[model samples]
Target: MNGVSEVFSTILLTSIFLALVFMLLPFSYYTIMGSVAKTEYEYVKHGFYSIATYFPMIATGGEYSIDFPSQYTSRGYIETGRIDIYLNSSSQPTLSFPCMALTQGASVGGAPRGLLYGVDTYIVNDSRMIPRIYEYRDGNGLMIMTLDTCRLLLDVNIVPTGNYSGYYYVLTYYNLTISFRGSGSLRIEPVRMYTVYSNIGGNLWNITIVVSDYILGKSFSYSVIDLVKMGFGKEYAGIPFSLTIVVEELVVEV
Candidate 1:
């Protein structure tokens, strides 16, 4: 009888231990996977910040590539995700063409995640109206885009108008779509730039930059004064004058 009782007690303890482990298995797996996903998200965010910081150094037709993580644990498998750029105009922006960065499968707890650069309003003169980038929404997900002073000047060339006393500014807008896929190298290049100008009033001209992304089938326009406020041109003190502006286009590939 004593030997049988001892055997029964051992069996009961073993059953309880296995049951506890079975119950905790799912919780443990999720905790570890969630941690891994968060780490991957941070890594990607840092990569984007670095790119935005040095984006201006890349010249027209120049390309920059970044490697993404091999696996996104949150998605329950390894796959490539995408990074999107959006014009963030929730409020007035102080930077020249401010943008935000949004990523797919990089969120925690269903909360929105993105990066915002060049937030200092004091960096440029205040403009009457700040131009906004065309908003692009991916389902119910948020989109983000960012542009810095250097990046803004990458395609802009300012020259002295020999015929006139004022300066001539050439602003280029690249209208292209970038599709970044999983764990692969993502490449970015200023493929093409187009410029358009219209005289709004006296010295104040409505310089519109129309950018199109064919892959997304959408296009939007914003003013050029956003550049002027960044010290792109001088404010004329005398009467409002006009100059003969020429529109130009250049095409390149990734």
Candidate 2:
């Protein structure tokens, strides 16, 4: 009788131990998985925010390739209504990148206004407008575009004339990183020109350049002529005449 009782007690304790382990297994798994998922979400969020700030710093015209987590896909655009970047996400880990442009006065209308973040406003007048929209890709691939600078020169070789139709404007690029291809073309558009005499006058212009890259999401137009136009004509000709540009540099940010 004593032996039998001991055997029964041992059996009962073994069964109880197994039951307890089975009960706790699922709870342990649940806790671990939840923590892992939360970690992933936080990490991805940090990366998304970083992109919002980092992009504009390098958003000059050119091909760009950025590496992101394998699970996410992102695209970027410059808002014309206001100076901001709107990021769109389409994937498992959805997200958005939104922020003001590093440079200011980047509006749809080509009129020059305030400086963007204290940086000089480069594009001015009706000639060049804000780059309305653009996009990016996942897995950090490649971006290629033409980058150039529009310099307002008080003195240049351009002869001032009433008709001024006979003079051809040359746009020379300085920090150009990518080569021209496909339907890519450089065009000089006349925005507005005011002339006092032949050599003394102001001209507002819109310079447009086309870039072709599958990596880039869309085509955009913007200029830096306005930022450099400030404080120059204020000294000369009572009102001052400012409308001369020299293509200074060629390169885009990545």
Candidate 3:
């Protein structure tokens, strides 16, 4: 009887020990898996954090593009004056990109003088500045002096808006050239002209303008007199000074 009782007690203790180990095995596995998942989450968050700070610096240089990991899906858009990038739902986004403008180069030639650098624009704006105008008086009242007595060339760049990734160039120039000589008399009148050309996007464009000395009304009186004479007088029979130009737009695909 004593031997049987000891065997029974030993068997009971062994069974209890085995059951406890079985329960603890599952708990141990769960704890280790939880720690690994937390570590992976932190790594992904750190990667996105680094990207947010790096984007601003690259944007200033030019257009920036990048591809994300294949396992996750992402989306990018500009909203409320900022660019937002969203990665997978589980990961924090690499977001908040700075707004960047598309840029273009503008160049103006002074005929024989060559290309002027100081007046050029690396990035386009709403209103651009043209080449400097140097005026002097001779026997001919006022005239637009040219480079090496040549004509004036104006090169304009129509900068793209939004995400248009392409190359575009618009070239316009005045064919007329003026030489200041004591013999020539300055004509006080309004000069009207227009430039017609296609844009990089293959669209027709016409720009009409009236050139006059607004500061000195001297030409205004002449313009009025000419208008009166146009009714009957020969002085205003023909358009005093007018120019019209048309050209196919110069587009370079890059």
Candidate 3 — which residues are off by over 4 angstroms? Answer: 1-3, 61-254
Model 1 local distance difference test score: 0.39
Best by lDDT: 1
Lowest summed lDDT window (length 10), candidate 1: 74-83
Whole-model lDDT values for every prediction: 0.39, 0.30, 0.28
Better of 1 and 3 by lDDT: 1
Q: What is the TM-score of each candidate against the true structure?
A: 0.55, 0.29, 0.25
Predicted candidate 2 versus true structure: per-residue lDDT over 1-254, tens digit per residue: 99999999999999999999999999998777655544543443344334334433333333233332322222222321211111122122121111221111111112222221111222333222222222222233222111122212233233455854222222222222322222212211222233321322324233332222222233333332322233223222122233333332323222
lDDT of 3 by residue, 152-213 (tens): 12222324558642323332221212222322111111123344533333322222222222
Q: What is the lDDT of residue 105 in candidate 3?
A: 13
- Runs of candidate 2 exceeding 4 Å displacement: 62-254
Which of the two candidates, 1 or 2, achieves a greater lDDT against the reference?
A: 1
- Highest TM-score among the candidates is held by which one? 1
How close to the true structure is residue 243 of candidate 1, measured as C-alpha lDDT? 22
lDDT of 1 by residue, 32-94 (tens): 887887677666556556655544444334566676573752211111111121222323222
Q: How many residue pairs clash per model?
A: 9, 28, 3
